[model samples]
Target: MREDAPVWELEAATFDADHTQALAARLGEQLQAGDLLVLSGELGAGKTTFTQGLGTGMGVREGIISPTFVLVRIHPNLPDGPRSGGPDLVHVDAYRLGSAAEIDDIDLENTMDSSVTVVEWGEDRVEHLSDSRLEIALVRSEGAAVTPAGDFHHNDPKDAGGRDGVITDFDEDDDNEERLIRITAYGERWAGRKPDLSVD
Candidate 1:
């Protein structure tokens, strides 16, 4: 699902480690200061992987690992980009947040006006922090056990025959690989005089 405004979805059959880095790089190319990215998905859904790509693309300090225990990690940008104006990246993990009030203690909104903030597990809790945000939803699909080229045979031995080559399709089918990354430009630029986020 996608909209010219502010919501979309991305689907994939598998999420290898390489895809994580690639996603980040692609996002970095489109990012700028004051951008807020809110991520929502189940565990092992590649939230951190996406961030890694974004970090690399932005020329941020290497090793943009998840700040699970610490709740947040700040990656500073190098001074060699087109414009290095503020702190590079402010990465936040809102999964451990006990209550809505805890969000204020993080004090991320103060930085949103100048930095790119990526919040993991911040679906509903962090929307108040910024009116303008990019929401990403990732869904994993189950693909075929065997390939048309006959490389990977059927998973079920009973279905591995010669005459029929009986392919008892598993409930989980292999789907195409695609990342549904939705970018919503809200606020004034989107439809009003005063926008929540200003790209310029």
Candidate 2:
């Protein structure tokens, strides 16, 4: 609940979108309903790509897309499908949310207990939604900056409201950027448990 909260963290690097998705899929297998995943990353850090993998592992229905403009997207569990018993995926984009009060305005507590909630760009906004949560940060490695060199990000839209966070300022046409992801487990929900991050 505090900044010095009970926590344990691990670091893993992903070389591509596939690796990011694979890593998240592994975690998805271990998660259950009422779990919260907080994702932090600059634009183009594969947040959506990672969430897609999570949905796949959780056995949710397809069509996992960025909820930036839509704000929230719920991918329900697939009936009679693989991982059909898994929980639904509730993806929330908090990039435009300016405060905790705003996050509460959406009434997340209503569905969090029955769904796997993942919040993108929710570094400090949605931590209180649960007693324990998985805080994941995806960082672009050096030489892999989101903004290409010599390109000033004047009037960056992230500062503006109502964005989906799927667009990037950098060109990935020939660039293969690696992302460093750090996952931290907090509260009693994850106590004494170490995730087996065996992503192949």
What are the runs in model 2 whose C-alpha is more than 4 Å off? 1-6, 143-176
| Ten contiguous residues with the weakest lDDT in model 2 | 148-157
**Local accuracy by lDDT, each model:** 0.59, 0.77
Q: Candidate 1 has what TM-score?
A: 0.66
Provide C-alpha RMSD values for all models, in order: 11.8, 8.8
lDDT of 1 by residue, 1-200 (tens): 13234322222222344654565565576677787778865666567877887787777787888888899888988788533543488899999996668978888877887778998988767777766667665444344332211121112323322322222332222222322333333433223221121111
Off by over 4 Å in 1: 1-15, 81-87, 144-200
Looking at candidate 2, what is the lDDT of residue 87?
89
Assess the local accuracy of residue 26 in candidate 1 as a C-alpha lDDT between 0 and 100: 57
Q: Against the true structure, what is each candidate's TM-score?
A: 0.66, 0.82
In model 1, where is the ten-residue run with the lowest total lDDT? Answer: 146-155
Q: Report how far off residue 106 is in candidate 1 (Å).
A: 1.1
